[model samples]
Target: MASKESVCDSYLSLKPEKATIIEIIRSLFSSDLENERFIESSEEGKLERKWIILVSVIVQWVFLYIRVPLAKIGDVLQKWLNLISINGGLLMLFLNWLRGKVVEPDSLSSRSVLGNLDTRIELDKSIKPENTRYKAVLSIMAAKLSYENKDLVQSVVNHHWKMKFIGFYNFWNGYQGRDSTQAFLFKDTQSDPNLIVVAFRGTAPFNADAWRIDFDISWCQFNKVGKTHGGFMKALGMQPENRWPLELENDDQHSQFAYYTIRKMLKDLLQEDENAKFILTGHSLGGALAVLFAGVLAMHDCEYAWLLERLEGVYTFGQPRVGDEKFGEFMKEKFRNHDVRYMRYVYNNDLVPRVPFDDKALLFEHFGPTLYYNSCYGGKVLKEEPNKNYFSLRWFIPNRLNAVWELIRSFILPLVKGSEYREGWFMRLWRVAGLVFPGIPDHIPQDYVNLTRLGTLLLPKETPKVQHSE
Candidate 1:
């Protein structure tokens, strides 16, 4: 059995349920965090750090109360959306309902709420295999599809993308003590030796577990690699025994760890076809996992250097900061040494990319230039996206005005780009939400899909001029 308590030496773990009202308020001024049963830390926490912990616990407490109802609402909404699709349209749905001939949606064939919001299952036709943007386009598509069901994934991969569906998995999280992480693998035949793409699923809209993980400020330190998000590491399937062992013996009976299992699969496949390369990608939380996956491979470089050599790239969209400054330096060195391409994409005002608070209080930071696209689909390579920390009084009206432009762009894009760029009714509603919360709607895969197809800037070639790298 994996013992969660014994996982890391220097760490802070939050248990909101174990806290009291007095303790929660007192934590802000308290230095001895280890003294509190609700807070677990290797050493005394700074007053500023405890403030973050207080916010985290409070948010988690609220989530615990709303998790079930939120999930129910999402379930009902997804089913309703699937009904509209299954019946062929909203009008058709109504007409069929009057005649008592409405079609029921099959759960296996239906899309998740994230999928229903965008509803584009096909890859961009204009982006060819020869195009430099092809992998990034394919990556965003895979990241979008990752939100859908397994059958939907197979259908899209086989019928539309003309790819082989490897498998869909629900991997185990040791800390969560159950299967909490999800990812899927497929092989793209468009390339000569066939490229295998492993896309980790991003945070689901209704999943409280994922939301809690995202908000958790807990961290664990590695010898020379620096500290990383404890929630993300756990979600990536870190085991309690020695954290990350190169190989595990007689592990057949135990639940599969995402890192080890995916690593083994890629190793075997690469060995079978020597010329094949692979890419890791995801959107939002998935994006964090994708980059960290690459980071971990680099960490075990001596034993698994072959995987790094065969890795084509890592592309992430609306991805949050994963680790500290030192960790960022470590990964940058690894990428530079391995000649691996790491493209972190941020569509205008996407809040997810700017999180886990990169400040003096929190150690999380995003490394490398961001391939940022504004609402007009204008692209730039920047060291950091504007409004690096999202909550800003300075950007308040400007952000909402930008949101208004996005809403207008939703109407104009179809005329300028094509019918393919037209926003769906549900997607437009999400854009409305942007008026209130500027970046939340922008975090959706819809804008990401549009930007990849319409954005002008080609990466790497356009990146090195130091366009916005202040």
Candidate 2:
């Protein structure tokens, strides 16, 4: 393990599990944050920093307390849903149950909470490998599919998509000391030179730890590169003890770190086929990791320049801000230097992309071109999405009205857009929930999947290049 002294100069780490409720409250009023047991800061920080840290710690602490129960609830809910799915809908399920002929769901079945919500596992046949928008369409599907178990992902890749199923990984997080991050890789053999995609899994609905990562505001500030989200860094396999080393020694007893293991695999794979290029993609938290993977490759440019050169693009859906303004600028310069294309997809009022609050207090900001799409799947290339901060009262009524339109659209879509575009009851229920909180249903993969398939037609022929004016 690398020593703390060998690590970067500045970092602010939050350990909510170590903090007591009284200590958490006391942190709000106290100025000496370095002295707090739950916090490990390189220097004394501003009052605003304390407020952000306090909120993060409180949220994480709450999540830590509820983690087990929340997971249990998710497990039970998944099993029950799978049970219904196995018997072919609720009506059939009840009939079969009464007849004692209902089938039990397999432990590692195709059913998932996210899958249950959208219920569309197969790719759109209308969008083929030869289409101009094929890569983007395939990326969103892979991102959506990453949320499922290995067996299901493999089945979809090999059987449905007719692609090579590389592997699915659950990598170790050094900070959390657990296998928390997940990603899958596959090759699009239908295309020339074969495009490889690395899709990181997004946050699960009932996973408290995943939610904690989204809420954690801890950061590590590099000298010239600027501060990055600590939670995201850890999820991407940044070691607290050794920090972000380019290489790690092999140990059969130890678990794999995402960056190291994935980097090694990509290096080997690319070596075998020089013509092949790869894309990084994800949704929500996974999106953060996807871009950060490229950023880290830039950080070690001398060693990983080849990898960056071969990186075709990064496609993210409903991704949040990962770093400060400086970090954004750094990434923009790097992408420009390498001529790498980055398309960030945001659907309507999705709240994930608008956060860790892009304000004077918090330093997190998003870079790259956002392919913004509305609830109706209308597309626009913009630097940022509208309603930059999602909590404003002015847009509340409009958001609710849009949610109403979405719920109505759910019923009418199947009739107009063909049966393939049909949404399940769970998704319709989520749209109903969106009536109260509009962003919730908007952030799902279903809309993103819809956008990639339909938004291409709505996009103008002459779209603008990357905007860095911000």
Candidate 3:
């Protein structure tokens, strides 16, 4: 019999890395002239006889202890056991055959060459910036309170695009403050009045800058409350813990707030001396708000239509399902001037993407192409173990068990429940286990990969040169 090391050596000599999987299998099964004579001469036949005797004795003892009296029952049990043993032995033989065939001699060389070539090309491209007609600016808007603190506001806006992070408080203060708020404050002061990008951040303590983006735009909160109104803070949902509002604020309040702010910005932009286009983008809660505001703009007719006609586009990231199906369809149709592209990024089997909304009345009827990446796969391991085999029985058995368990929970459990299984105690446990297990790969969101690809493609093309005048 050939030693394990000798078998491995022989397999590696075949240059499995350069060959296809089928070719590798063929090579392993092909008769080798040198090894044939040794196998024929070996006393492995005697060893096989001894193993069969041992198995027979064990089977006889098991049958005696079980107290099965009939000779026919004993004979049937023996036949079943023999069949199981034969199949198990065949499985092991096949696995060993694969192991010998699948060794890749030049894997390291191939991987290294590819890595080096990619790195060199990327390095060369990063050094140079391209000049393009359109400048891409990422505006992160803040919620109400951030606008009040001038220092915080200044810090956020000081960087690129003079981005301002506004919150509900800022909106309230801006509109209802001691002095009447100017409707289109930022729009009045932009350098290139032709192109504008407006993005909103959702909820309180808004900090859009927390997420990395290229540009920043000054944001002003549009207070969405009127008299017979609770205090400004209460309407904005900033009341102290003890004073939480008992009733949910109407969608109209939120819609009006977003509409007023957007209208003011548009009026100021159109009123400016130069002609420019505008684009709107937001994520999550902000995305819902952006859609609402866009719908309102469409409703106001030509004053807004003429302005939006010059609009470039709208991109909402991870936006919840919002508006009735008909309203959603109406909004998309009415906004003919701009293309409303909604991008939802889900992470690791997250349930947030399935927000409650009428499917038949979905505003954005079309779902864009989905791009997948393996970032979350193989779990985010900092280091790989040395001398670890990618395919091993030890690794496969547990993985197979895990796969079976997941299929039962994800597929079977739902059938029993008569509905889709929500992530509850049992689901959470499995997710936690998946995180720990190396065999089970993690799931990554398609949007995250798409964004990265977009960044790579665009980043090399241009670098925004920030200009400052003291």
Worst 10 residues of 2 by lDDT: 461-470
Residues 303-335, model 1: lDDT tens digits: 777789999889999999999998899888888
lDDT of 3 at 25: 40
Using TM-score as the measure, which candidate wins? 2
- For 170-218, candidate 2 gives per-residue lDDT tens digits of 8776435354688999998988889999999998888787888899888
Count of backbone collisions in candidate 2: 0
Q: What does each candidate score in C-alpha RMSD?
A: 3.2, 2.9, 31.3
- Give the 10-residue window scoring lowest on summed lDDT in candidate 1: 1-10
The estimated TM-scores of all candidates read 0.93, 0.94, 0.37
lDDT of 3 at 95: 70
Candidate 1: misplaced stretches above 4 Å? 1-9, 20-32, 45-47, 174-179, 253-255, 461-465
Tens digit per residue, CA lDDT, model 3, 42-143: 222322222222232233233333332443453454344333333344465467456774222232122111111111111111221132212222322321
